[model samples]
Target: MTSELIAALRARLGDERVSTAESVREQHSHGEGHHAPSMPAAVVFAQSTDDVAQTLALCNAHRVPLAAFGAGTSLEGHVNPPEGGISLDLSRMTELLSVNPQDMDCRVQAGITRQALNQILRDTGLFFPVDPGGEATIGGMCATRASGTAAVRYGTIRENVLGLTAVLADGRVMRTGGRVRKSATGYDLTHLLIGSEGTLGVITEIQLRLHPIPETIAAAVVQFETLSDAVATAIDILQFGVPIGRLELLDEVQMDASIRYSGLTGLRALPTLFLEFVGGPEAVREQIAVVEAIVSDRGGLGFDWHTDPDQRAALWRARHHAYWACLAYRPGYSAMTTDAIVPISVLAELVAGVKEDIAESGLTAPIVGHVGDGNFHTIILVPPTPEGLAQAWALDRKIVRRALALGGSCSGEHGIGLGKREFMADEHDPVALEVMRGFKKTMDPNGILNPGKML
Candidate 1:
């Protein structure tokens, strides 16, 4: 049967695009998640929307599970193919279809990465702002509804995506929404696929909204004596309407890990907030003054700001590398990062409680967050042992439950992929869960599209 399916794919796409090689199959079998390894039987390198449609048609007819492969950077095993079918990789489909500068939008193939798109638009004075820390494909980012530090001001992929072209489970090619924004039209199928994790359909092309490059930008690192103080300062800054472009918090443990991993620093390992302001020169200066005053009043130490592009990139690169730094703190161990978001008023209390929980559990987890949006993540390093893994999973569940109880979500940017499926019923009411299941069934009756994913 496997040979028959491979033969069909080869017939449709030719020998150059289809492969049954062990290395290629293994490469497409798993993503950067803690899930156990599982390899697919074959891999297909798709080069166009027609290629994706044809591949899905063949997989559907054969009753073989099909999974879309992006950059394989998903943290929740969203791209892992456990059923040993075919991995439809879109990496070869990287292409910029069109750029409409006047409309402030662009059409791109699903495999285009955020960094790649930004580099392509460097001379256009427009850029996409949804950064999910690691460089991820636009399709995968949209599938996960990913956001990052800049999401506080720029919003997530859910907000920036204007429209999409997707292949439904039955091999039907459909387009949702259009170049003109703001539609009150019927069901929002466009958004339905944004966080579906490729269960309902496979995205082939995307129309994304872009923002004008800011005229002036500045970043600052403000250190605090306590985690509570840092959170409190963040809340105050947001409440004062300071127009901060990015406001991130890093606890002492995270600071220590970062400094040790990056080396060469005179900085103390205290709780810190990395912030950025973007606007005109006068407006940015005003916002900076307000932020400085708030942090100083909250017992913050020397507040340093950078305006140079290289210096700004260096600071953010260090910030984006926090996950790696935390993992390095414990050699021979992987990380399971949990994300949650709460109201700004309750952020300080929740963070303080998390600190207590980590201390009581005796776990080596550091805290970091996009504080302006009241979203935070705890990067926990777990040794490759049954006991350690069990303990880490337990702590993660406890944190999610706590977040739910406090009117927060189990995940802020990371979607509910393989890891958080069980928590969906608890997070959303049973009625809402049923609605999601209904949508899943309506779109994918056979359940061949990324089976075992969300819902």
Candidate 2:
């Protein structure tokens, strides 16, 4: 049966596009996460929507599980196929389909990475703002509802995506929403698939809303004596309506790790806030003035702002390479990061409690966050052993439970892949989960589309 499936795929897409090689299977087996990798029987590099459609049709008929894979940068196991069937690779379907400058939107094949799309739009006086750090494909971002540094101002993929073309499990095609901004459409199916994480269907093309390049932009780094002071300043910025483009927080431990790894200069290893302000020059100045005052009031070190693009990038290098920095800081250890977000009113207290938890657990977990949005992550460091894995998960669960107790969620941006699947029942309403499973069953009844995930 495996040989038959491979032959059928090769006949349709040619042997160049179909692979049964051990190396190719290894590449498609998992995403960049802690989950154990599971190799598929075959990897099919899909080149077009028709290719995806035909492949799904054949797989559906054969009752073979199909997992859609893009750039394998997903933090959760979104690309992992634990059931082990066919891995549908979409990295080749990367053509820019259309762009409507008047509407500030563009259409591209799902495999286009955010960095590549922004480069393509560099001369268009507009840019895509969903920067989830790594070179994640837009399709994967849509699948996981990803957000990053710019989320405080530009919003997440859920808000920026205008529409998409998807292939259902039975090889049927459906187009949702369009170039026009607002529509009283039926059911809002566009959003329904945004964060489905490949359980419902495979996204092939995306229509994304773009933002104008900021006329003036500046970034600042403010050091705080304590975690409370740093978090309090972030909360004040949110409440003051400062329209910050990006607001990030890093605890002392993360700061130290990042500083050494990224070769950061002159910055102390203290809890700090990285803030970006964007607007007209005068407006940016006013925003900075307000934030500086807030930081001062909170007993923070003076706000040191940088306007040069290179300098701004340098200042943010530590935050961007945080994971690698943490690994370097603790040799022979792996870190399992947790995504816990809570209300702003309770963020300070929650962070203080997390510090206590980490200290009591005797673990070296560094903290970082998109504090403007009440979201934070902690990387629990442990040896790369079975006992270490168990310890990491235990602490992760404790942090998640604490966040939930404060009316927060177990995951803020990372979707419920293999890591957080068990927490879904606690994070959402039971009826909501029921409706979601119903949607999955209605869309992919045979359970061949990325089976054993998100439900």
Candidate 3:
């Protein structure tokens, strides 16, 4: 049966596009997560939306599972093909279909990487702002509803995506939403598919909203003696309307790891807040003043501000590399990073508790987050030993439970994928899970579209 399906796909897309080779199947089997790799039966490189539709049609007929593959940067097991069916690699479909600079939006094929899209928009004075650290495909970002430091100001992929063209499980092509900024449409299928993790449908094309390049941008690094102090200062700055483009918090352990990994000197190994302001020169200066005042009031020390593009990029690059730095602390051990968001009012307590939890667990994990949006991440290095894995899993669950207790989610940007599926029933009520299952069944009756993902 598998051979017949592969033969049919080869006939439709040519042998060059379809591959049952061991190497290709193994390459598409896993993502960056901690899950053990499992090879898919075959891999299909789709060149167009029509190709995706046809592939889905064939898979639907054969009852073969179909999994969408992007850059494979998923922190959870989002790209894993658990059922060992056909993995659809979308890299070949990369294309910037059209750019409407006047309307501040662009149409792009699902496989276009954020870096590539931003490069194409360099001369247009507009760029996409959703950066998930790694160069992830726009389709995967939309699928996971990804966000990053810029999310506080620009929102996540969910808000930036204006519309999407998707292929349903039944191989029907459907368009959701429109180019307009606002809509009161019936079902909001665009949002439904945004964070579906490719379980409901396969996104083929995306219309994304872009932001104009700011005239002046500045970044500031402020160090504090305590995590509570840093969190309190960040909350105060937000409350004072600082117009911060990006506000992130990194504990002393994370700062130390970053300094060692990047070989930087003169950085204090203390809890810190990394902030960026984007606007006119005057506005940026005003925002900086507000932030400085708040930090000073909260016992922050040595406020260093960088306005030069190169210097600012260097600082953010170090910040973005925090995860890698954390991993370097424990060589030969894989890192398990988890993100959670809490209310701004309780952020200080939450961060403080997390720091204590890590200390109690006797684990050397670094903490960082987009504090402006009340979201944070804990990067813990997990040894390959069975005991180490068990301890890491327990810590992950504990953090999720704590976040939920404090009116936050188990995951802020990372989707459920395979990692957090067990927490779905705990995060959402039974009724809510039922509603999600209803949507899943409605869109994928055969359960062949990334089965075992999310719900």
Q: Which runs of model 1 end up more than 4 angstroms from their true locations?
A: none
Arranged by lDDT with the best first, the candidates are 2, 3, 1
Using lDDT, give the best candidate's number.
2
Q: Write the per-residue lDDT of candidate 1 for residues 311-412, one digit (tens) a residue.
A: 788788888889889888999988989988888888887888888788877878999889889999999888789998888888888888888888888988
- The 0-to-1 C-alpha lDDT of every candidate, in the order given, reads 0.89, 0.90, 0.90
C-alpha RMSD values across all candidates: 1.2, 1.1, 1.1
Number of colliding residue pairs in model 3: 0
Q: What's model 2's TM-score?
A: 0.98
TM-score of each: 0.98, 0.98, 0.98
lDDT of 1 at 288: 92
Candidate 3 per-residue lDDT over residues 1-455, each given as its tens digit: 77889999999999999988888888898998888777889999998999999999999999999899999999889999888999999987789999999999999999999989999999999999998977799999999999998998999999999899999998899999989999997989999999999999999999999999999999888889888899999899888877789999999999999989976567888998888999999999988888878888899997889899988888889888888888787888889998888889888878887877788887778998899999999997898799998888778878888888888888999889999988888788999999999999988999999998898
lDDT of 1 at 382: 88
